[model samples]
Target: MKVDALYREQEQLAKKAVFYDAFGKLDSIAGIDCSYYGDLIIGGAVVIDLNTLEPVEKAHTILKLDFPYIPGLLAYREAKAMISACRKLKSDVDVLMIDGFGTNHPRRCGIATQIGLQLEMPTIGVGKSFLCGNIRDDGYVYQGAERTGKLIYSSRSKKPVYVSPGHRISLDTSVELVEKCMKSDRIPEPTRLAHEYVTGVKNTLK
Candidate 1:
């Protein structure tokens, strides 16, 4: 999909959609993470059983980061690596949890959205920090209370990360799944584990 077409597609989907509804069936989930070599990208994906939370399969791939770190066009830089890794997975995933924002992006089509849309699978975005949208300290859980259609300003830098719905999931569901996946630390278990594995491999190659 072209970069400019993202917003148009989102607008069309938004008009006819119910933002949140019980999906009713989800047994397996996959997580994706990427590491960069000075700008070159390497991706890792792991599929885990939702009931046992045990890893069933994993895959990794490396791809050149051809695009610059553009604010709204991040999928162009990372999607190829993610897709490559995901294609290698031996098991099918009912849902995907990505280390990014979902429905929390400027374009409303972040990397997680891109992947989910392309693969026609459910996906969620969970970033360590705010991407877009205002996070309310008021303890409200819903998107309206937290904020929407706003950029998530980072403390370290003014440039914000993008978040948005990936596919077959609601923003509220994304948030809930993220909380469930958390294992004490801020990062979720699948993403955290993938990070550890990929970083370990990168370190060994050094």
Candidate 2:
């Protein structure tokens, strides 16, 4: 995949603020996660009803690996399988919460952003570790009081994992959603469940 083209496509989606308004009366959200099998990628997309916090549907798939694991080109390697799994959903998702970055990338495009743009849906990126952003520790309390005026630096490489919009959301909303989805830990519940499902499926296959 041409990096420049992909970047341009996502940038356009980000610029079109109208797309962000599509998220109307969202009742459910889905979380997607993948596990690599040496040469293959097996993944699962789990949809949970926000009101009840129960699993509504799940889609899983295994795809042969084709792209190399480039530092920033992860979407190319995993987008096909992720999209395939998402297509298996029988119900429409109000929002998609992915276990990766969104606009918090070198090209302002990440797996979450790419997938959201392709599907034209609202998506959130919640990374497990730092990818490319900075987190200030200016007496900010963790796992409690919400941090105020915390800005993610997309222009800095050494920055921390940024919480930004993907297709149909705002940066502030994304960060708040992430915080709301957290279940007594740093990782959110949707992504944590996805990680467990993906890893469990991979282990069973092995």
Candidate 3:
């Protein structure tokens, strides 16, 4: 019954997400990721200057795992900590790049979508792996006939990353911005750094 309620909440929030670019300015972007250690989860957010690709601000929050790990309902388990980390950022990022799915999910509401809706901020989801949808010949992922996201290989020798609009952003813009933020790694810098940041925080406990 609780899971059913969560699914309904996702459906409602997904409807509220704007599938177009609704934000002004493109100066900075924040990357959000969460790391785990035992029963603790550490959420990290790192804001980077777009032109320079240098981190301007970063924040993190450590919390106990209050929610169980569910496959399709990750937002319910990790979004609270990620939101706390994002709220701690003093820098006004133009968009958030989260390491999860967005509209690519079965319910069209992934962790990235949930965070963007809850925060009312522009966001993109840069997923390391596919959660749903099948890749068509054009390299775009589709849920049945509707396009969900795109798959692009940041490194030709490595696996591709999935790019999708989370909220207040368009699929084209999401792909463009993620390409700009890409460094030598397959993961975009904002999310890649945030992953490192949170991992480092988790390591300190060991």
Candidate 4:
């Protein structure tokens, strides 16, 4: 499909996103991330027990890149491998935290939103860099006049990670959960481990 068409699709799907709280107590959380190797995509998922903040289960998947990496339409390129790896997990997690943007995008439909909607699960997005918003003194990220998400400085980092609701989740809860998952790393444990796993797989191939 053309770029314009894909943009339109993102806008349409974003309307289905839910901003209210839709979950009970979160016992476990999973984080997913993808690494690239030429035309291949290596995706990894790590599920951690929320109480101890230790990994309970992990899985990885390697797949071909079907879509080009566009600026805003990242889900088209990476969501496939991410979802595949996530589905490989035997333990069911209460939430899925993905290493990407959620509603904090131009169209409000990011890779995390796409993946959450596809999996019918609650998901949060963690953007390492500022995507498309102005961070206020209160740390709320704003796209134009609408509040999209929040900027949180994790315990071990000078930089802040943007946290946003992907689907079937609220922004406040997204931040709360992400902060709980952070260990001695700037990124949350789930996603941090997932990234490390995928990077290890990529290194092995080289």
What local lDDT score does residue 131 receive in model 1, on the 0 to 100 scale? Answer: 55
TM-score of each: 0.77, 0.80, 0.97, 0.97
Query: Please, what are the lDDT tens digits per residue for candidate 1 over residues 93-186?
Result: 7788887755566655667777776776777766656654555554322354433322333334444332344667776566566556655555
Better of 1 and 2 by lDDT: 2
Off by over 4 Å in 4: none
lDDT string, candidate 2, 113-172, tens digits:
888888888888776565654445752212233222233323323333345566677666
Candidate 4 lDDT over 1-206, as tens digits, reads 99999999999999998887788888999989999999999999999999998888989999988898789999999999999998899997889999999999999999999999999899999999999988898999999998898988877789988999999999989999888888788898888999999999999989
Candidate 2, which ten residues in sequence have the lowest lDDT sum?
140-149
lDDT of 3: 0.91
Give per-residue lDDT, candidate 4, residue 48: 91
Which TM-score value belongs to model 3?
0.97
Q: How much does candidate 4 score in TM-score?
A: 0.97
lDDT of each: 0.67, 0.70, 0.91, 0.92
Say which prediction, candidate 1 or candidate 2, comes out ahead on TM-score.
Answer: 2
Candidate 2 similarity to native, TM-score = 0.80
Per candidate, the number of residue pairs that clash is 9, 4, 0, 0
TM-score of 1: 0.77
lDDT of 3 by residue, 8-56 (tens): 9889988998889997779999999999999999999999999999999
